[model samples]
Target: MSVVNPGDTVPSAKVVVSDHVSFEQFVVSRSRALLRTAYLLTQDRHLAEDLVQTSLAKWWAARRRVTGDPEPYVRRIMVNEFASGWRRRWRGERPTAEPPDTHGPAIEPHTDLWAALANLPRRQRAVIVLRFFDDLTEADTAKTLGVSVGTVKSQTARALATLRIDPLLKAD
Candidate 1:
């Protein structure tokens, strides 16, 4: 048995060192995926970067308790952060000018889909992202959003209904 004192520096090769390394690897391996999810949720590159950074910093501080897979926990942080901010300021960008013609592939199909997604309400957007994009089950989606499965079901139903009727996606 050991009595850890406030002023004592005991061992250097214990949980902290290993946990730090694991957390660093976690950041490297998952940052891109997290950023993509964040971009989908926030619909802005700058905001997505900020959200991912903020979520990583948060998870790092709580690394001790973040055992097993950390992606879900980090995702929960990003989603909650976006949701809270959404409740405050509800605005997103709209591209007015069309993309310049080039010899590359065109992204016509995704444009309408993204536009329709952007118009969804906050909870509905989160529900759609987690359920469809992330491919989490309804129970997992409910757990991540801190809502009931019934709420997730209803939000998904409503969001899908709205998307199905959107003029932009209707032409797709």
Candidate 2:
């Protein structure tokens, strides 16, 4: 019961469609969670959306190799991609006396927490987002970031300490 014709160039069409269905189901169920994590990593809605889209495309291409839950694998891809983008941007960034107005003024979040989060370095931000925002264990955060659990612990500690010292977040 093959869908291929004798002269057809395309083979395994049915298998491809079935695999696509599984991937679609996985995306439907988990996209919001992924998007939230990406937002935490990027702190911008458009970048977060693009990050999730790219991560899903990469995951779909490598779906065959992914066994069991895809959440962790997809998360790892998102973190890596964001970090790569960060590095590229870091290299290209030209410091100016005044910030560029390409996006105009940013609409800051109501709470000071987001502002504090933005102050941390990229890796620390990633660790905090994975450990607290995404609710992953320290070991899992380390795995996602390709670092050791102790590194995750230290980064999380440093991020928390920075946030704690923020004047805006100080008790009234």
Candidate 3:
């Protein structure tokens, strides 16, 4: 039997059967990519992990009803979750005068672009991330966001316009 590694991409030819094993395989193969997309959407690593976990839990609960490729459905869930403002309250830690010590290298290289992206309204930011970062077609982006294709187009246009004039981006 062929072995499937966690990092391996799920084969497109293999149909997703409505079974827990299939779902587990799908999660193992796709979670990293989903985490990356979540990071782009939420702009915070911890939030991104929570977002992915939340989306996956939702998808798992509805797995029996899910058909065809599950990626889009999970993506829709992530976008919806991000847009719904269901965030955990910051009760454990409070900001202090001095930053915490760090020895690890920086995680993000495109701080300027990310900062500019953070400035965008949620919908516009979603459109930009779905269309460009995820390389989804405008129609696919619309379907993921549960909006019209025209809405996706307009949002993308507005986001690009804003990015073009962002001071951080313009400084480069």
Candidate 4:
């Protein structure tokens, strides 16, 4: 049998540890921003949390292969996850006809904008979130969504047009 090379194996083991540390640091630094972006995409706090966790888990699994700024990679994962309509396997909570009462004052100031955003089609919504909320350029948004820049521009234009005319925003 051929002998194993210690030099070849040892460095790779160190690299794995280094990569793990980098990934951990990335998660610590970016989790909040990621959660905010996810919240905008999902429009529900619980769903946003779930989206961030799922995207991070998927990113962690492929961490070694990723290079440069991990934010874009993580963001791309979030966008893709949101677009594909990721849902929980077991939705234990059932919706009630009547809304539950809350004790605290309303925190979100831009409820009308959120409502308008919620009404947008998924692709247009993704474009709006990535371009406006995340502040990505047309080229960058296109790269993240794996679409052409023209598609990003067109979607952005269409979403904005729809939002401008939305009755929810008009009421405000």
> Runs in model 3 with CA error above 4 Å?
1-21, 88-109
Query: TM-score of model 1 relative to the true fold?
Result: 0.74
Judge candidate 2 at residue 30 and give its lDDT.
92
Which scores better on TM-score, 2 or 4? 4
**Model 1 ranges with Cα > 4 A deviation:** 1-21, 86-107
Question: Candidate 3, residues 1-172: lDDT per residue as tens digits?
Answer: 2534334675565335465447668888998999999999888887788788788878978877888788889989998777645452233333342122322343343776777787787778888988888999988988888899999989999989988887666655
lDDT of 4: 0.75
Q: What is the C-alpha RMSD of each candidate to the true structure, in Å?
A: 10.3, 8.6, 8.3, 10.1
- What is the number of backbone collisions in each predicted candidate, taken in the order shown? 0, 0, 0, 0
- Model 4, runs deviating above 4 Å: 1-21, 88-109
Better of 1 and 4 by TM-score: 4
Query: Candidate 2, which segments miss by more than 4 Å at Cα?
Result: 1-21, 86-110
Q: Please identify which of the two predictions, 1 or 3, would achieve the higher TM-score against the true structure.
A: 3
Tens digits of per-residue lDDT for model 4, 1-172: 2423213342222223143456556666889999999888888887788788788777878877887677788889988877755652234333342122222343343876776787786678889999988889999999999999999999999999999887666644
What local lDDT score does residue 39 receive in model 3, on the 0 to 100 scale?
A: 92
Ranking by lDDT: 1, 3, 4, 2
Worst 10 residues of 2 by lDDT: 97-106
- TM-scores for all candidates? 0.74, 0.74, 0.75, 0.75
